[model samples]
Target: MKDTPRFAPDDRPSGGWGSLKAVAVSMFREEAPISTAHALLKQNKPGGFACVSCAWAKPAKPHAAEFCENGAKATAWELTDKRLPARFFETHTVSELQTWSDHDLEAGGRLTVPLRWDAGLDRYVEVSWEEAFAAIGAELRALQAEQAESVVFYASGRASLETSYMYQLLARLYGNNNLPDSSNMCHESTSVGLKQSLGVPVGTVTLDDFEHCDAVFFFGQNPGVNSPRMLHQLQDARRRGVPIVSFNPLRERGLVSFANPQSPLEMLTPAQTAISTQYLQVKNGGDIAAITGLCKWLIEGDDAALQSGARRLLDAAFIAEHTQGFEDFAAFVRRTEWAEIERESGLDRASLESAAATFAAAKSVICVYGMGLTQHRKGVLNVQMLTNLLLLGGHIGREGAGICPVRGHSNVQGQRTVGITEKPELAPLDRLAELYGFEPPRKKGLNTVEACEGVLDGSVRAFIGLGGNFVRAVPDTQRIEAAWQKLRLTVHIATKLNHSHLLPGEVSYLLPCLGRIEIDRQAGGAQTVSVEDSTGFMHASDGVAEPAEDTLRSEAAIVASIAQATLAPNPKVPWSQWVGDYALVRDAIEATWPEIFGDFNRRFRAPGGFQRPIPARHREWKTDSGKAHFATPADLRTDPDTPEPDADTLRLMTVRSDDQFNTTVYSLDDRFRGIYGTRMVLLMNAADIARLGLAEGAIVTAETAVNDGFHRAVAGLRVTTYDIPAGCAAGYFPECNPLMPLAHHAEGSKVPAAKAIPIRLRATKPA
Candidate 1:
């Protein structure tokens, strides 16, 4: 960790010369040829490969450069010319490699071939694909003989829909439904909450809905860094004079203003478009109270309006016809005192009422949120409360009105749609049985948190990761990594080396796979895969660049080969045939989900693809009540699972830097926040720093504010003052993941409460 971080407040708006310079630097750092970069970037358009970054929807009418700065970085990272050959592994032992930082480890570049950990040599050794599959098959078969539930199949969101479909199928055919993916860590709350209220697990809005929306309400989402492509829509909405309201703990730069790099006029001139018409700095874990305040103000105003013989404030007809439990929700909101709402939300009554005035005046609105709302103890409640606010004004199932949960990975939602889930009811097991001629598993599977528990208890013997650095991404990182070594078997299908790969099991294998930007050649000649965006629209993605290594296989082929080697010759599942042509995979998906993915191939071939059927979008509720339900929060506090923190405990939230994507670090700089050269700094409010009697740049140790008998702490973090709310602190993710307790998760969704970790800081001696 650096002793002093370069702290320069950036007054300029996001996405101008800074973004362009970052993109160019990434290309140069990866040694990507200018021509090759241009060609690959051009392919990020409609018919080309999807950006393996955020899941923001692409426009139907695309621009020449449709990619964002982070998108370009992801492309360059995948298409890097650097390669890790057999000799590279021979020189670096597993123990030695474990000491390297994540960025440096991946900078060694793409894995060229299959490699297996040799206990005798204490290093990884190259192995043939046939031998690798045979060994993995033997281990899986042995594990299945004991208990199929002992194995875990983890999938990453970067995979294509075809690959995810095949991967989930392989897990079920082997006997258990222990399938967990990236969604378990991020948007599981959105899925669980929306389904119970709106009768749909996914968001109802489309990209076109942004066009007709009268106002946009953003909750805890920083689009400039997480999904830069979304800035284009916000810019357009701003130009059209639509009001944008933002609710977050920190005053994020993305929500304040933006200068689109794609705009020649803005780039040439000093013009920058302001994004948020109103920015409210809510306290961490205070969204429920903030939303409740809005609802209360609206209902009171409605009462006064009706008594005075003015126009009805709420859509009374829509509420009566399309919703239920409104009276109970309204009663609860009306009873909620103003003092509690103001204290919890960290905003005055005047501000919330003023914001509510804007919301009530708008005819239609789009409520958008991100992981900050979903990664808390009362995550499900937070989502349902936001939905309740929309229902008050009948802002749903209409042309510009709905809830939008902005997802991170490109195909995360698609993965869940295609059956990468631990819940059996979510997947059509009966249909899968009819299609595959085998009975699927009926018992529920372990989710990510439960899987970690299983691994710790020695119940889960093996783990097969489709893609991702699971060990680094999960909470209680140190504990999980120690338990991971005791596992019997571990298999990672990856494009490049990461921290998770270095933590090998007793019998572990690292198999190289082709990245999204590279050409995937099979017997079908050239294949195109599909991914569902955050807006529920599905589209085709085919690579135009050459593969980093010819021996690297596609993710679909690898999963298919493993299935073939492990399972008996099942006539229904022609694994090899499906591997030869990916259309067979799509056909099988369509057969399994005929209602949603009807005519999968034909529809995918259409320009800009088609939207998946969302029942709630048409005002058709699939719930038991057959109507959208207004769900009241269990209590006012958003962090209900954990006890209220003491006065000194500041809630800590993990965030992503501008130069990073999820767990992948492109550089040490957080350009948007103006913090450079280090990620080990803690962001705190100036008042909190003074109250805690800590210096501006003092070295500190943050310990978990829990009585769980576990000593969880991270030391040597330099404290830097920022514009965060009092009693709140912020730090980059994965670095702060270790401080979170694995058991501290959402009650229903089970997503780790990363956004509201209670911690108290103490000054540390200078290192």
Candidate 2:
């Protein structure tokens, strides 16, 4: 190992010299500082493209340097000078590459051309784009012939709006709605919860709202590594004396303190801005309990305040006008005892009441959360409880007050906005059929979890991944891979090589595509793609750097080509026409959602683009009762998706390293947690380690608490003592995914319970 594993308390700020050092190392590794420098200048700026790494909202009027360290790293990674030629693939066998780590595989560099798996030679052979597309089409056609439901079309967040719209259109035209996406694995819970509560699935707050907010509640998220750009906004909030409360299982460095690299004063001094005024270390799967506790406290306070004839803490007028089921919700909270709340949340009454007091004082509050809250069995319920808390303050629709589901990936929300959903809405389908002359499918399709189940049951035959490492990212790593192997064909359209590409199907095709920072040239010269940020800002992104390879196609072009190849005989839509002009795709999108995407092409070119109308943002509830609904605490039960663990079991949640984004590992070092040069380590509470009669740094095996007749074990994980809640442990995923079962997921969202897996650890022999 280059560096021995080290441990520190992570006392430093988030975006100071450490971020700069990491960015410099990444730029050096790419060996294209000049190109990367030019590209970085345009990143997240007006008249330029957005960063591919995250979906953090940018400033309306971007500063001279609006990009963050990770943004620079993401750009450099995409614009790296290294290239994988055809000869390299010929020299390396699939089995040989399988031995490489996920980082090492992608480190070999960007894919330069289309490659087809040669089963006979056990190596990938170069194939023309036309030939590869034809082969893929043939496989897809054959699968469709057997059963239209057999073919699953999957998309990742990296896909552009143009590509996502076209891909979904293609799937619907092909008589299938099997449009599974990365959202299925990430923020599906947020969508389901928010839609049920506020009648809108997207975030209600805007970038400008941050400046006016009185309080910000961050739940189950680490912005330091996941969304570094959010630190700038957070730091600004801190400076303005806004109270930021964090409810998480771990005390992440980003949420604790941050030094904005963009701030001159912060960079010049040792002083780091304190971010979280209150940090609640709620146990895994305890968010719903914690949030419910807060709600109950608020309910009690409001009731007392009403009895005294003092100013009511609750917004009585707003509740009466814009909310329903408040009486029932309040009754349930009053009936629920504090014993269960304290037992489940791992927190006492004092802390919950203190947080509630802070909420009662704040007029405008923003509640933001990430996968930590949604990757549990009660994920949807967790979110609904959060909404209930915000609703008490009449937080939705007011300035600086709303629910924000901070999504990963630059365009995951954009993918949905452009209609990349398993359940296609009737309005969009009808519009598409009227405008495009095709009968869009109405039946619900497979999600990420269901898609895997489909593969296992032989219901799904072909799998096409638009972008992302599906095999590695999904839960039950072995089972997912085995199911992929059974597929007739697997197509991966990506920039870099990863494990998913190595796990080839009977006839596999790897189609190389343009990265976000690469110029996308078609027959109509240069083209730009659009994406929506977490804040609902839809902006156009124009790539500055040259293409990694001329053979590589734009994501839009690839989807268009595939559609043309598969649906050729008098296709319903003009596939070739949209391939040459992305503006045409935008036109179709504008037509489909005229209210939301009016003048998409023209408005997208504006300074900061346009924000989608959020019904809840205007206090306009679009629910069945035309009002916001609060979930009763008693109504929520323990998530049935996760098996109840025995007394000896500990809940395990998967996290990402500071040096990585999603499944992309920049380096093995987790600088915040102070772990270095390895990904197979587990972060356990000191008490838990002692309880197991294990010493720190001891090699151990983690087995699932309950076995549902499926093999769920991840062995050889080095245990390290950390300040986590007792009986709770954390590990980085893709590595720890093997320990998670596919059947274990949130009931409503179907998102894998990655954050709350019941596990047990035992000491093992040193490697």
TM-score per candidate, chains pooled: 0.99, 0.98
After superposing candidate 2, which stretches have Cα over 4 Å from the reference? 1-4, 635-638, 641-645
lDDT string for model 2 (1-767, tens) is 36676666567988888888888889889888888888888889877888899999977688777888778888888999998889998889999999999989887789998999999999999999989988888877877787888888999898889899999988987888888888999899988988999998888988888989999999998998889888877888988999999999988999999887777887898978999999999988888778878888887888998999987889988898889989998888888789988988898989989988888899899998999888888888888888988989889899888888999999999998888899866238888888877677788889999998987888888888999999899998987877778788899999999999998989999999999888889888898999999989999999888898788888888888888788745545888888888898899899889899998989998888899988788888889989999876554445564556566789999999988888998888888888888888899898888787888889998988765888688888988878789888999988999988888888788998899888887778642
Question: What lDDT score goes with residue 570 in model 1?
Answer: 92
lDDT of each: 0.90, 0.87
Clashes of 1: 0
In angstroms, give how far residue 185 of model 1 lies from its true place.
0.3
Tens-digit per-residue lDDT, 519-623, candidate 1: 789997888899999988888888878888888999999998899889988999888888888899899999888888999998986666789999998999999
Q: Pick the candidate with the highest TM-score.
A: 1
Window of ten residues with lowest summed lDDT in model 1: 35-44
TM-score of 1: 0.99
